[model samples]
Target: MKPLNITYIYDYANLQVEEVRGSNISLKNRLAKLEQALRNKDELAENLHVIDFEQLKIENQQLNEKIEERNEELHKLRKKTIVTVQIITHMREKVQFVQKEYQILKEELAQLDQDLGAQRDLVTKTKHERDEHRQEYASLKQQTGIMNSEHLTKDFKDRAERIKELKELITQLKKRHSQMSQFIKSHGGVI
Candidate 1:
C-alpha cells in the first residue's frame, strides 16, 4: 500500500518541479551573464564569483532533486494507469462472454418455441384423425344395425307365413279324418 504521505509528496513534488524548471531557465541566464563578465575580467565579477557559483550549485542540486521526485511520481502514476487499463480489458471480455451466452440462450429459446409449435400442430392433427376414425366407426356401426334389423324382420315374417299354412293344413286333415270315421259307422254290418 502506498503511504498517505506519498500523495502529499507527489503533490509537493509536482509544484516544486514546475518551480525548479523555471529556476533552471533563470540559472541558465545567470550563467551566461557570469561567462560574459568573466571574459571581460571585471573586478566585481572576480570578487563575487565564489559566492555566486556556490549559490548556483545549491540551486542546481535542489532543482535536480525536485525533478527526480517528480519523475518518481510520474512512474507510479504510469503503473496505476496500466493496471486500470488491464482491469478494463478484463471487464470487457467478461461482458463479451455474457453476451455470447445470452445469444445462445435466445437461440435455444427460439428453437424450443418452434418445437412447441410443431408439437401443437401434431396434437391438432392427431385429434382430427382420431375424430375421423370415430366417425367412420359410427357410420359402420349404423349400417350394421340396419342390416341386422332387416334380417330379423324378414325372418319373423317368414316364420309367421309358415305357421298360417300349417294351421290350414291341419284343419283340412281333421275334417277328412272325421268324414272317414262317419262312413265306417254308417256301414255298420251285424253279420
Candidate 2:
C-alpha cells in the first residue's frame, strides 16, 4: 500500500469521536461518520507499518557496517600483537647474550684474583730471601775484617761467587717475568 501520514488520520478520527460525544448532529449520521473515520485510521496505521519496516532495514544495515568496522580493528590489533611478540623475542635473545658475557667476565675476574694472591706470596718470599742475603753478606764482611790477608783474599773470592749466583738468580727472575707477560698478552689480559 502507498505510504500516507498516519497522525493526520488519527487526529481526524479523534475529532469525529469528540464531535459525536456532544454535537446536535443526528445520531445515525454521526455514527456513520465515526465508523468511516475509524476505518481510515486503521488504513493509515497499516501504511505506517511500511515506514517502520523501512526504518528497521536502515538500522540493520548500520549494525552490519559497525560489525565490519569492529572486525577490521580486531585484525589490526592482532597484527600489532604479533609484532610485539617478535620484539620481545629479540630482546630476550639480547638479554641471554648479555648474561653469557657477564658470566665470562666474572670468571676472568676470579682468575685475576688468584693470580694476585700468587704474586703477593712471591713478593713475600723475595723479601725474606733478600733479608737472608743481607745477613750473610754482613757476616762475610766481619770475617774479612778480623782475618789475615790470605783469609781475607779467600773471603773476597767467596763474595765474588755469591755475587755471580745473585746475578744468575736475577736473570732467571727476569725471564720468568717476561714469560708471564707474554702469557698475559696471549690471554687478552693486561699485566
Candidate 3:
C-alpha cells in the first residue's frame, strides 16, 4: 500500500513531452512567414521614397527655369526704360534750342521793322519835297505865260504895220544890195 507503481507514470510523462515539441515547431514556422512579409514592406517603402525624391527634383528644375525667364524679361524692361528716358532728355534739349532761336528771330524782326519805319519816313520826306518843287515850277510857268500875253497884246497891230512897211523897205534894200554887189565886184572885194 505504501509503494506505488512508477512504470505507468513514466509512460504518461513521455506522451506530454511529445505534444509540447510539436507545438513549438508550428510557432517557429509562423514567425518565419511574418519576417518575410516585413522585409517585403521595407522594400516597397524604399521604392516610394525614390519616386518622391525624383518628382521633387523635377519640380525644382521647372521653378528655376521660370525664374530665369522672369529675370530676362525684367532686364529688357529696364533697358527700354533707359532708352525712353534718354529720348525724353534729347527732346527737351531740342525744345530749349528752338525757344532760344525763336527769341533771336523775334529780335531780328523787331530791328527790321524799325529800319522799315525809318525808310518810310525818308520816302515821305522825298515825296513832300518833290511836290513843293512841282508847285514852284508850275507857278513860274504861269508867270512866264502872263508876261508873253501882255507883250503880244501890246505889239500885235504895230508889228503888223511895221511888217508892211518893212516889206517896201526890203525891196529898196534889195536894189541897193544889188548896186553894192556890182560896185564890190568892180572894186575886187569879196561880194
> Which model scores highest in TM-score?
2
Positional deviation of residue 29's Cα in model 2 after best superposition, in angstroms? 15
Model 3, position 102, has a per-residue lDDT of 96
Q: After aligning candidate 3 to the native by TM-score, how far in Å is the CA of 29 from where it should be?
A: 27
Q: What does candidate 2's lDDT look like per residue over 1-191, in tens digits?
A: 87877888899888988887657457767888999998998888778778878888899999999999999999999999999999999999999999999999999999999999999999999999999999998888788776646887899999999999999999999999999999999989965
Clashes of 2: 0
Predicted structure with the largest lDDT when compared to the true one: 1
TM-scores, one per candidate:
0.37, 0.42, 0.40
Report the C-alpha lDDT of model 3 over 138-174, residue by residue, as the tens digit.
8887888866576786788789999999999999999
Ten-residue segment with the worst summed lDDT in candidate 1?
182-191
Regions more than 4 Å wrong, model 2:
1-45, 123-191
Clashing pairs in 2: none
User: What TM-score does structure 3 among the candidates reach?
Assistant: 0.40
Clashing pairs in 1: none
lDDT of each residue in 71-93, candidate 1, tens digit only: 99999999999999999999999
Q: Name the better of 1 and 2 by lDDT.
A: 1
